[model samples]
Target: MANTREIKNRIESVQQTRKITNAMYLIASTKLRKARNDLANTRPYFDALRGEIKRVFRTAGDVDSPYFYPPDNNTPLEGTYGCLVITADKGLAGVYNQNVIKEAEKLLAQHPDTKLYVVGEYGRRYFDQHRIPIEHSFLYTAQNPTLDRAREISALLLDGFLTGTLKEIFVVYTDMESSLLSEAKSTRLLPFHRMQFTPPAKEKAVQEPFEFYPSVGAVLNSMIPSYVSGFLYSALLDSFCSEQNARMTAMDAANQNAEELLSALRLQYNRVRQAAITQEITEISAGAAAQRRTFGSEG
Candidate 1:
């Protein structure tokens, strides 16, 4: 059994830790709320952008645009696969970063000729430490996702796609289903797949015959980049929200564990203190009895 002083110190240490964890939990909660709001607010615009792209693909038939359909099945997979990995900049987010990295690793292992384009400091540092080759690294972009930032990343990716450097592109990120549930997922971003677009019976294409100012291909070229940026930006926001949610959950658990530890330490301290006091009382009683006997004998 530890002495009262030792147990008291342990209790104080746990209390301090509890305070830190509680503060972190509160911080994460606030950030999570903001991230959720931002994600929700941008979702509509993202959906509209995707809808417009799909509509364009549906309207423009037999246009030899690479962005309209998936890569040719007959074409052998020979080019390097580009993977954009999204992770958090800091730790203390539980398994948030690890899960996404593991997902990316699995995908990369399947394709030996792959290049990593990491977003966030954590992923970049992790890959560098592991001696993995990084094609490009973007830092400090995941937390505050914006159109401009997304555009920058899109430009790089689009250039690679246009140059045939990246045969296929995919984004590995954490998809947040809810506050308590999130899963790391890999989504193909390039070699755009054809999605079946259904329109309302009331809204017919003949009723709204659209004419392109320059050409359909020119319009598509502009729309494709914007659409890609929006998609990537949405992924960034989802990842940010997931990171906050994970951190909040982890901190809440840590705070609870600290409370339990503090309770046990306090109980130990009380037991040790009571034992010391009882021993002191026993010694005092024995000394008094001996003194009283000696005095009576002498008298």
Candidate 2:
């Protein structure tokens, strides 16, 4: 009976766990859908801005801009580096936070003189627990990534780079390749490299000479800030989407495991119950036989 009671308690616990996990799964699914829509809406704009920047650099001959390259070639080996790490604020997301934190650690290892700017609580906690100093941390931004928030983060990084406080800047986050897949990736956000752009084929319409509002360099200078903000925003969206997807998958798995455990526990409980019933029947029969033997002796 005790064993049966314990099993019953376990069954109840599993059921409650399953309920929580199933609810979490549904919530994550809803968040993932919203994140996906947000990503779809902003991705094209960012892509276009990026492409235009590259095109300008390609066609505009002999352009010089502070945004195009690092301040100097002779950056000291011990120069401080800036790392922006994006992670989920909450846990139970199946390594979504760990991957980004690990990637950030790798960057920190490479550049020991680093100022950390974290975008989530998880990374901040990990770094704090490890005794790593964080220069800045933005909370509640990952859940709802916006252009204004991206610009705010970009401003900090840009100021550090331009002022020679940080020699280079890197952003570490998890990228959502698909609903089922997420991968950690790092992108250098500073010391921009000029991309090699190929001209369109002759079959395409001949492009005309384009004129910038002021000059190509000036236009680039003006656009670089917004471009960086857009890039960061895109990364934030990807990381947010990845987190949701990971949470959904984790909760789904937990629910399934709970169901399996409940099944096994139920079977054990049934067997124990059958054994108890059989023992009771045996005891009753033996008592009746003893009474009948006493009656025969009396006669």
Candidate 3:
């Protein structure tokens, strides 16, 4: 049992911690909403971009480009693979960063010759501490994901792929399925497969032909980079939203735990206080009775 003063101090400490956690919860909520809105605002353009790519594939008829290809079953897997890993700059977001790092590790284990391009400080530090080499780290982009930042990242990756520096590129990030559910996922970014652009069976309909400016390949070359940028932007938004949601959930749980601890501490404080009061009263009564006996003897 702690003394009353110690218990009081403990209660105050917990109260302060609760305040911090509550504030963090509110901040995370705001961030989550903003990220979702950004996603909504940008989704239509990307959706249209994707639709246009599909249309080009449908109308262009077996276009020969470096970007579009089917995987060769006979080709041996050689050359450095590029992995773009997204993680939070700071943690307290439950297992959000852990899940993403784990996913990246899984990718690395399968493809040992990977060149890591990390997006967050957390991921960069983790890989550095583990002695794993990172080819690049995009600092300050995880927390502030913008269109320009996405474009910059995509441009670097596209350059690497086009220059034959990287054979394949993949992005590891978290996808927010709902407010309560988020899952880490890895998606291949390069060597766009024709089947990936194909619409679903239900959505397939008659297509209209589109005339290219100079040639179909030339037009596709221009469009593919922007389309890849859009894809990267969407992934960043998703990962940010998931990180914020995870933080909100973690803070909410901390707040609840703090409340429970405060409740128990208050109850214990009251019990200790009552016991001290009772002991004081007993001591005073005994002293008063002794004084009365002394006076009677004197009389």
Candidate 4:
């Protein structure tokens, strides 16, 4: 049992800690809400870009577009794949970073020869711990993500895909479903999937040929990269929001625990002080009684 003095000091410390944790939790909760709204607003644009490119691929060229179709099956086994792993720069969220790292590890194991690209410090640390060779990595993405960062990352992946250095490129990240739920997702970024979106069965391409200002190929080249940018941006946004939510959730738990500890300490402090006072009172009363008896007997 700790002395009242020591326990009192501990109670004060925990109170201070609780205050800080509460503040952090509130801030994180607010940020998570905002991030979700931001991502939702841009989802339509991303969808439109994706739909436009896929539709273009269906009718773009007389010959098959190289980007639309799969290349030789043997190429993937022989060609290196670039994996972009997204994880928190710092981790406090429950299992968010861990889940992403696990998924990335599984993806990496599928390819014996791969060019690993690490995006954040956490992911980089994970690969280093596993002794996986990282061919390229970026460590400077802002705590609050930006579109330019996504563009740069997308461009790098596109370059690898075009150069034949990487037959496939994938982004492994956490997809934010909500404050409490974020799922790890591994998605292939290139070569772009050609999904054909056609008009209604009653309508035909000949009935209403969509006009391309330059050409479908040219239009697709621009839109596809934009679509990629949006996807990567969404991942980063999801991760940032998830990190905040996790931190907030953890801090809230810590704060509650601290409050409980403080309550226990206060109760003990009061009991100990009351016991000391009662003991002093009993001793004084007994001493006075003994003096009264001694004096009376002597007289």
Candidate 5:
């Protein structure tokens, strides 16, 4: 007994929604491919940096580099540690945003009350909803992501650690092994192993002690910051690509769900309309038989 006008209106509305979801799906797919390729291209650069770090550690002298500090328990844990959680700005993938949000939640659960550094608008909103504190936020657009901007953010995080404002720094980001496989991981940003500085367990003769032009400490001073910045930037890029891939997958699933829903609704609408028509025909036939009997009796 549904109104015909209401059914028509609903169908039109669903059709419009279907169009929008379809368009978004297409857009996400295109962006996903671009991001995936971009991330792949950036890998060699990261590998080169890794090689440079290994090489630098090999030649470093007796002087203790700031980057090579050991995590001492007795160092007196003062001040708070902040976590940087990187997630995508938009949501459409099935459970993509939810899974990341859950990861953030778990991170927060470990720390009684830790501040959040978020890279996406969606993450900020999620923190706000959960009563989590957000210390800093950076939102990026799809068209352009600047390395300088990423470096600036990384510098802030490192400065906080250096100045004792933030006791320790941890970054939670999605690692993109492949388009199909993405994982959220947390890693300490600083205090790399000095012992293992000279690449791991390959029987090459240890080179002679490294000589510094200015000072080894001074060289460490410059390179440590760059190393931190470069590594963070690379991680962010990987997460960025993962975000796009996650979104693309999510949107694809959403588009499919929407299509399935439309199909179901359409079927329901047809069945209801057909039943309504059949009932009308039954009423008409009944009325005609009743009229014929009345007419024959009158005659």
Candidate 6:
């Protein structure tokens, strides 16, 4: 049975909270739409690049390239594995950061000697707090994902792989399957095999013979880096979209809960106010009747 003032304050607080959550929801929605549009805008270029790579593989038979790691290449790689973990910069996005961090932990457990490359401040802090060593942290890229950032990341990874400092590279990110569903998953980036780019049997078309300017190997060497950059860019976009969607959902739920709380608080405030008014009226009526009785007796 709190006083009306206390209830009114609570109601105002809930209303303020509701306004913040609603604003967050709208912001997240806008971000999500922009991310989707950006992805859509860049998709055709990547699709063409992928198609070209597939064509090269199909037309150029038995090419020797540094990017292609065949199954039977017995040359053991000398370095440890590298993993790039993608996470959101800030949290509030209901379990989005947690799920990706859990996925990264699983990977680290499996590859104990992995070199960790983190993308977000949240992931960097989490790993640091847990005493897990981070090889590198790409600052300010998680929130503002751009082609330049993706290219920079891919360049570094390619350099490590080329220099034999990292044997294999993998990325852990969240994929937005739909507006309501997102899954944290890992994708291997380096030492790509030809089978991965090969078109399916059903989708295969007749390949026309084409000649490369320098050689097939040289052409592949040039194309592989762009392909890798494109792949990384797509992964970043997916993770961003997933984060936005998760935030939107979380904010929506918060807004609803705030509304419910405000409703209850307002009801309680009305009840308390009515009771106070009734009590005051009762006291006034009783006092007046008593004074009238005194006057009547005096008269």
Q: Estimate each model's TM-score.
A: 0.92, 0.91, 0.95, 0.86, 0.81, 0.94
lDDT by residue for model 6 (1-299), tens: 79987888888888888889899899999989999999999989999998888888777647787787874774535569899999999998999999999988897888787999999989999999999999989987587689999999999999988998899899999999999889999888888767877778787665666989889889989998998898899999999999999999999999989988888888888888999999999999999999999999999
Q: Give one digit per residue, the lDDT tens place, for model 5 in 127-243.
A: 888777789887664234456866887788878877777776778877778768988887766556565456566746446765676876776667777767767776777777777
TM-score comparison, 1 vs 4, better candidate: 1
Structural RMSD, model 3: 1.8
True-structure Cα RMSD, model 2: 2.7
Clashing pairs in 1: none
Better of 2 and 4 by TM-score: 2
Where is the poorest 10-residue window by lDDT in model 1?
Answer: 68-77
Model 4: per-residue Cα lDDT over 154-257, one tens digit each: 88888887777888888888876765677888887766543343334554454356787676666666676787789889888888887887788789789879
lDDT of 6: 0.88
Of candidates 3 and 2, the better by TM-score: 3
lDDT, residue 50, candidate 1: 68
**Residue 167 C-alpha lDDT in model 5:** 71
TM for candidate 3 is 0.95
Report lDDT (Cα) of residue 243, candidate 3.
96
| Off by more than 4 A, model 5 | 60-63, 71-79, 108-115, 129-131, 139-144, 195-197, 206-211, 290-299
lDDT of 4: 0.77
lDDT of 5 at 111: 69
The per-residue C-alpha lDDT of model 3 at residue 242 equals 96
For TM-score, the strongest prediction is 3
| Model 2 local distance difference test score | 0.83
In model 6, the runs with Cα more than 4 Å from the true position are: 71-79, 203-207
Instruction: Give lDDT tens digits, candidate 2, residues 182-223.
Output: 999988887675543323444243268788988888888888
- Model 3 agreement with the true structure over 51-135: per-residue lDDT tens digits: 8887777775567778866434324347899999999999999999999999999999999999999999899889999999999
Each model's lDDT: 0.83, 0.83, 0.90, 0.77, 0.71, 0.88
Clashing pairs in 5: 93-250
Clashes of 4: 0
lDDT top scorer = 3
Runs in model 2 deviating more than 4 A are: 70-78, 196-207
